[model samples]
Target chain A: QKEVEQDPGPLSVPEGAIVSLNCTYSNSAFQYFMWYRQYSRKGPELLMYTYSSGNKEDGRFTAQVDKSSKYISLFIRDSQPSDSATYLCAMSAGDSGGGADGLTFGKGTHLIIQP
Target chain B: DAGITQSPRYKITETGRQVTLMCHQTWSHSYMFWYRQDLGHGLRLIYYSAAADITDKGEVPDGYVVSRSKTENFPLTLESATRSQTSVYFCASSGAGQGLISPLHFGNGTRLTVT
Candidate 1:
């Protein structure tokens, strides 16, 4: 199985709808979880970041991580057409000395917010 | 101008030709990474560097070479480009303060096509 699994979804939603994107990871050592948003033909940009388990909120976006279940999620509240993009989930198992392997990324979920 | 930037936003080259993608960051981050994004593969790491002169291979590094002669520049070179190597390349950098778990800032991306 892949280290990280995410549905490559072209999920479409109406404006102001709530959107939930999820990912499952097989690696238990991943302590740092992040969500990135990528527009067409552009690189991924960091959206939300969380350490270990728990939830982190930033404006209309909220990120949650569950270490026990090896699951992570990003929720978008009141979505807009401008929010349409690809969302990628990334994580890493960091060492104490700082330097460690690069993050493993899941297949991004493509989202479309309809106006 | 303050963030990471990648050169030759679009490239078209013949197979077997050598191609180099340039990455420059203004932050002088301690960690630099090279990743390629494909339709089915999403994003896969090719190479990474923790500091100048230190480089390591990542998951998909077979056809790629990398050098980090300076902290702000990490270039990815494909000695003999293959059709399979045609994909969008992204350069990212993260600071050392948060170690390997630091959130990455990505460049706009370089789309390369190997004919």
Candidate 2:
């Protein structure tokens, strides 16, 4: 089984709808969790970040991590067309020596906010 | 100001050929990484460097190689390309290693196709 698993979602929602994207991991050592957004033909951009298990909120986005369950989630409020992109969950473990090892990424969920 | 840039945004090569993708960052980050994005696979790390001359293999680093001769440049090379290696390649850099909450900055991906 893959270390990190995420549904390859092409989920479509109306504007202003609340969207939830989630990921599950098999590794228990993952300590840092992050969410990235990738637009077509562009690189993945960091959207949210969390440490260990807990919730972190920024602007209209919220990231929740449940270490015991090995699950992570990203909540988007008031979705917009600009939010239409691929949402990726990434994690890292161990001491990064001021920078951790490479991040383990999920398959990413493709989301579209319809007008 | 260009933060991070990738050369030859699109590349097409034949199998068994040697190809190198260039990644440059201006942030002077301590960590740099190489990842490939394929269908059903969000992004898999191929290699990463903690600093110049300190490189390590990532999840999928069999047919590929990386060198960090400088702090700002992390190049990924496909020694002998195969049809299965056709994917979108991305390079990312972070200011600090794992434990610290550092967000990664990414370059516009390089789309490589091996036939």
Candidate 3:
């Protein structure tokens, strides 16, 4: 099984609606969860970050991590057309020193917010 | 100033050809990474470097290589390109901190098409 799993969603929603995107992982060792936004022909940009099992809120976005179930989620309030983009969920295990091992990512979910 | 810049924003090459994608960052970050995004496959790490001259393989490393000769640059080379290697390549950098906890800054991706 892939380390991380996310639905490839082209979810369409109306503007001002609430949007939720989620991911699940098979590795319990993953401790850091992150959400990234990518527009067409652009690079993925960091959107939300969380450590372990907890919830973090930034602006209109909220990231929640549940370590027990290895599930992570990102919620966007008052979604806008500008929020139409692919949402990627990424995670990493705790780093041991400066090694280049840790970051693992899931297949992103495409989202669209229409007027 | 450009945080991170990728050269040859778009590239097309034939099979068995050698192509190198260049990534440079102005932040002097201690960590740099190479990831490829394929349709319906999200983003997968190909390689990463914690510091100059230190590198490691990631999830998918076959047919590709990376070198970090300087803190500000990380380049990915396709030794012999294959059709499967056609994907959007992204380079990211992070400050001196633990992975799984640090937020990465990404550059505009390089769209590579191997015919």
Candidate 4:
């Protein structure tokens, strides 16, 4: 099985709706969790990140990580058309010598916010 | 600008040809990485470098070569390109001494099509 699993969803929702995207991982060593937003033809940008098992909130976005279940989630509040993009969950487990090993990414979820 | 940038935003090459994708980062980050994104496969690490002159392979490194001669540049070369090597490539960097959880900054990405 893949290390990380995420539904490649084209989930469509109306504006101002709440959207929840999730990912499940098989690795137990992952300590750093991140969410990235990728627009069409553009590289992904970091949206939110959390360490270990906890919740981190940033404005309309909230990132939650449950290490025991190997699950991570990103919730979007007051979604807008501008929020239509692919969301990818990435995780890493490395020492303090920097994260040169890079990260393991999920298949990504394609979210569409209708106007 | 003070961010990572990738060259040859779009490239088209024939099978068995050699092509090089360039990545430059102005942040002088201690860690640099190369990843390829494709449909169904999500994003997979190709290679990564920790500081200059230190490089290592990631999940998919076959048929590819990388060198980090300078701190700001990490180039990926296809020894002999195959149709399977065509994908969107991204370059990313993260700072060292950030305590194992530094966020990654990614370039705009390079799209290569092998025919």
Q: Pick the candidate with the highest TM-score.
A: 4
lDDT of 2 by residue, B2-106 (tens): 598998899999999999999999988888988899998779888988899999988899999889889999999999999999999999888875456577788
Interface C-alpha RMSD after superposing true interface residues, each candidate, one decimal: 3.2, 2.8, 3.7, 2.4
For every candidate in turn, the CA RMSD to the true structure comes to 1.8, 1.8, 2.1, 1.4
lDDT of each: 0.90, 0.89, 0.87, 0.92
Report, to 2 decimal places, the DockQ of model 4.
Answer: 0.63
- Model 3 chain B worst lDDT window (10 residues): B96-105
Model 2: docking quality category = medium
For candidate 1, lDDT tens digit of each residue in A38-80?
9998888889888899999999999999999999999999999
Model 3: residue B39 alpha-carbon error in angstroms: 1.2
**Candidate 4 ranges with C-alpha deviation above 4 Å:** A96-98, B98-100
Tens-place lDDT per residue, model 3, B1-115, is: 9599999999999999999999999987888989898877778889989899999888899999899889999999999999999999999888746433357778899999999
Worst-scoring 10-residue span by lDDT in model 4 chain B: B95-104
Error of 2 at A14 (Å): 0.8
What TM-score, to 2 decimals, does candidate 4 have? 0.97
Tens digit of lDDT per residue, candidate 4, span A11-95?
9999999999999999898888989999999999999877789999999999999999999999999999999999999998765
- Deviating ranges (above 4 Å) for candidate 2: A96-98, B97-100
Report the Cα lDDT for residue B58, model 3: 83
Better of 2 and 3 by DockQ: 2
Candidate 3 ranges with C-alpha deviation above 4 Å = A96-102, B98-101
TM-score: the better of candidates 1 and 3: 1
Deviation from native of the Cα of residue B47 in model 1, angstroms = 0.5
- Worst 10-residue lDDT window for candidate 2 chain A reads A93-102
